[model samples]
Target: MNLESLLLNNLHRFPPRVVAWIEKRLKAIPSIRQKIDKEYDDMMGGLESSLKPYKDRFPAFTELPAQGRDRAEILREMEAMQSQEEDRWREGMVSGAVYHGDQAHIDFLNRVYALHSQSNPLHADVWPSATKFEAEIVRMTANMLGGGADVVGTVSSGGTESILLAMKTYRDWGRAKGIRKPEMILPVTA
Candidate 1:
């Protein structure tokens, strides 16, 4: 049997620490290490082409350019790149990338973003509108979800941030309830 099969069949017989030690020793062998490296390199070589289609077409900068490129030229390059990458998401061929791909909706969002591009919500004194917008959004969402006046939430930039905020809130709530250790069970997929 191959090394993988041998390990898979026998790993359960040993403790986790013993299995880890054996794995480390096996990886330390020159032949085993070389074989593993070759396999990893081969896998990555296959993936690189698909992952970096623009690598050959676009100019990659390892360091800052001595002189800045023309604004029009940079915009043209960016537009071309976006056009090349957007088709799949726009066509609904991809999942979880573009939730709303309608042109009118996109244009409206673009206009809103342009208006508030320099507005930082952290500086609420300077950007009171940002705070108002976030509060309205949270209130509207809570109401829509059947939340009462006591429900509260903060707007997060994305999924990871939302998850982190939720976890912190739960931990704080647990602490207030005199729970010493707050534990959460999350799905494997999450």
Candidate 2:
């Protein structure tokens, strides 16, 4: 095992208060803080291209147009782009994505998705169906994970919300144990 794995393993053996004290002192080190910032910037730089593909190709709008663009024209541009771009994913030329590459299945899913395009589970008053679907998914997941009938789960939009929730849970647990500060040590592999 590397130095990080060894350090993390040892850290977990300490009480939470001791771990928090160590982390605070470690963060006070200039070199360690600088290295963390540099690594974070590098990771975000690598993700930027995938997240903002159309930033260079399409005209950006800070506000809506006085009138929307023509539906037919917008669709034609989208279809053209899709035809040229989709082959990469469909042929498995992309990483971290799964594609069936079946046109019929894709078409059926597109139609089904379009039907519910306006749904937002967060606003149950407006989108009761989406709320119901999310509830059912959470219930099924809880059961599959061997949680009892009283166990509850929530469906978050993505990684950011899920991570936030986990961090909050840890913070609350630490507070309950009389630790004002919480520190978590996750394996580098995780």
Q: Quote the lDDT for 32 in model 2.
A: 82
Deviation of model 1 at 91, angstroms: 2.7
| Winning candidate number (TM-score) | 1
Which regions of candidate 1 fall more than 4 Å away from where they truly are?
Answer: 1-3, 9-18, 168-190
Task: Give the per-residue Cα lDDT of candidate 1 at 161.
Answer: 84
What are the TM-scores, per candidate, against the unseen true structure? 0.80, 0.59
Question: After TM-score superposition, what is the CA distance of residue 105 in candidate 2 from its true location, in Å?
Answer: 4.1
Candidate 2: Cα lDDT at 137: 95
lDDT of 1 by residue, 1-190 (tens): 9977988798979998999999899999999899999999999998998898889998998999999989999999999989988887777788675788889999999999999999999999999999999999999999999999998778899877888988888889889999997777878677
- The list of candidate 2 runs beyond 4 A from truth reads 1-56, 99-105, 123-126, 186-190
Please, what are the lDDT tens digits per residue for candidate 2 over residues 42-137? 999878977777778877779999998999989987887788788888778876555465889989999979999988777899989887888899
- Per-model lDDT: 0.90, 0.83
